[model samples]
Target: MDTKISVVENGALKRVGKVFAEAFGQTPALLVADGNTLKAGGFETLRSLKEAGIVVRQYIFPSNPQPYADEYAIQIVHETLKQDNSIAVVLGSGTLNDITKRASSELDRPYMVVATAPSVDGYTSYGAAVSIGGFKQTLPCAAPLVVLADTKVLCKAPTDMTASGFGDCMAKFTAGMDWILADLLGVHPIRKDVWDMVQTPLRKVYKKRSSIARREASAIGILFDALSASGFAMQIMHDSRPASGAEHLISHVWEMEHLSKDGLPVSHGFKVAVGTMTIRYLYDQLKMVDINSISLIGGESWADRERAVRSFFKDPKVAEQTVVIAKKKFLEGEALSKRRETLLSIFPTLIKRIDEQLPPYAELKEAMRMNGAPVSPEDIASNLEGLRHAVTGAQMIRDRYTVLDLFYELGIFDQALESLQLM
Candidate 1:
């Protein structure tokens, strides 16, 4: 709702300056981009701003290692922006936008984005995903004031980028299911409007996999729209509950571990795509779970959980902080007993909801294949060992009640890990 203008037109870049002038009244702008994104639309973006009589400054990152949205990169942008009062105009996808978003928020200035690819849904989201102190976290930030994209540019983006966008979009299936699970478990309830805002557009995008793979303009536009819609949903909820879930947590673990291929960190969506498949597989396995045979862990003592957190994080400070967060949601004693009882009572309903909310695992895999998104850990250079570690670490790192937590609570985490190995 805070995003005032969103354009996905054919030559949106050509009119960006005019649009900005009309919306914000010719404010001085700080155009941010990287070497790659600069080559994509830098000249035109500058020319457009100039034509509209807007003074603009440029901050372009070199392509060699690329600009990571890490603490160092954020500080660089923050320091530069602090020297002036120019409004930030980020001209890239994902990381660049996240960096600018956080930097602008630190300065208490509104920023705009001109998307070069439909590679992520962070464009209009209210948090910047950054790696700081060796921990990957989402730093709260303001949503972009305006989001503009040229369908022509998005359609011509590298195939992997578009596929990554699709993968991120597809993650909504699991994210939605996780929210529903959390709601039923009394963790977090779903808001009808927010759920509809993200899920409705997602269904349409999912049906256009082939069109997206072929780079059809209409399909690409739809993908972009869905991605933006996801961002808006997150903004409205003031959290990523509606847009991220177990899959995203898995991605964060891989990110912190520096999982990479060809000496470059894996793309966020690609990691998430594999994670989506893994989570989907876990759900499939859950279908065959005989609740009668499974036994719940009575409850973990705070000391035991703290020790687990410490071991998982390997950093005393981070583990301490994690325990504090975990304490907020960790159940024990009567609460745990009640949770178990409630879970058993709703088992049938939960199964029904899972069946209704998730697409078949094979169907999801085929969709990824159709769109060229990774469908397995191997595709992203991750192994079962690393993935198993990620699954465990994911639950420890977040207090969110996802399927990982469900299995852990049910004392079947080892079984789930084994299933992942076999898969």
Candidate 2:
């Protein structure tokens, strides 16, 4: 909602200087980018801004180790901006955008982004998902004042980055279903407007899988638009519930643990892609479950859950912090009974809604495969056992009411894991 101007088209980058000049009247700007994105759109953006008579400075990060949105990165950007009055113009996808978003917010100045890739939905979202200390969390920040995404630039992005965007876009399917579960159970109700804003455009992007795989410009533009729509939905709702669910939590677990493959950190979209498939499979299994035949049982005690949380999070600070979160959602005795009863009573409706909400697992898998997104945990440098651990660990780290919490509260957490047979 904070984004005043958004242009997604071929050659939109050409308008960067004019747009920024119109908005800020030739305000001096800081162009933040890493080595890769700097090559992608940095020079063009710089030229465009200067042509419009805007003075500019550059903060080019070395791309070798690849920058991540952590506190250290934020401090550098914040200090850089603190030394001058220049507003920022970020030139990358997720990490650079997040770093600049947080730093700009800390400085109480607006910023813009020239997207080199359609790699994430955070471009128009109100919060920066960054690692503070060792824990990954969403830090409150303002959205960009303007977003300029060039399809030409986007179509040239590494195939994996586009695949990552596809994965993140595809995640909306399971994310929506998770919201349906929470809505139906009367825990968190759905907002139809925000739902339509995100889900409506999601289907259009999913239909362009083959085109996206070929790096077709129009389809890639559509994907960029859809990703931005999700961000706008988040901005409007001030919550990620409309765009993220258990799948994101799964990714969050890997993020906190710094999951990596082949010596490089895994991309967020790739991790979420795997999490999307896992959640869909879990939904598939849930469909076959006979709620009536299952007996309600007691859940873990708060002390036991606290111990598990502390044991799972190796970082003492993260563990100490997560123990409090774990306690907030731990259910037992009558509280657990009421939740299970509500689930049983609504089991038929839940299944029906899930059927209507989620696409067939095979169809979903093939779509992701077409986009070159990860279809399995191994594809993201994670194994089934690691995934299972992440799924359960996900519930403890966030108080978000998701299907993961549902299974735990229903006293069938281990049973669900056993059914998955992640081995």
Flag regions of model 2 displaced more than 4 Å. Answer: none
lDDT of each: 0.87, 0.89
| Each model's Cα RMSD | 2.0, 1.8
Q: In terms of TM-score, how similar is model 1 to the real structure? A: 0.94
Clashes of each: 0, 0
Model 2 lDDT vs. the true structure? 0.89
For residues 1-423, could you state the per-residue lDDT of candidate 1 as single tens digits? 679999998888999999889777878988999999898988999999999999998888898787888888988888888877888899999999999999999999888999999999989888888988767788988899999998988988888888899999999999998898889977798899999999999999988888888889889999999999999998888888899999989998888788999887889889999888888889888887888975544767878887787888876777788788777867788777677777777777888888788888888999999999998888898888888998888888787889888887776788899998766
Best by TM-score: 2
- What lDDT tens digits, residue by residue, belong to model 2 across residues 167-219? 99999999999999999889899999999999989999988888888999999
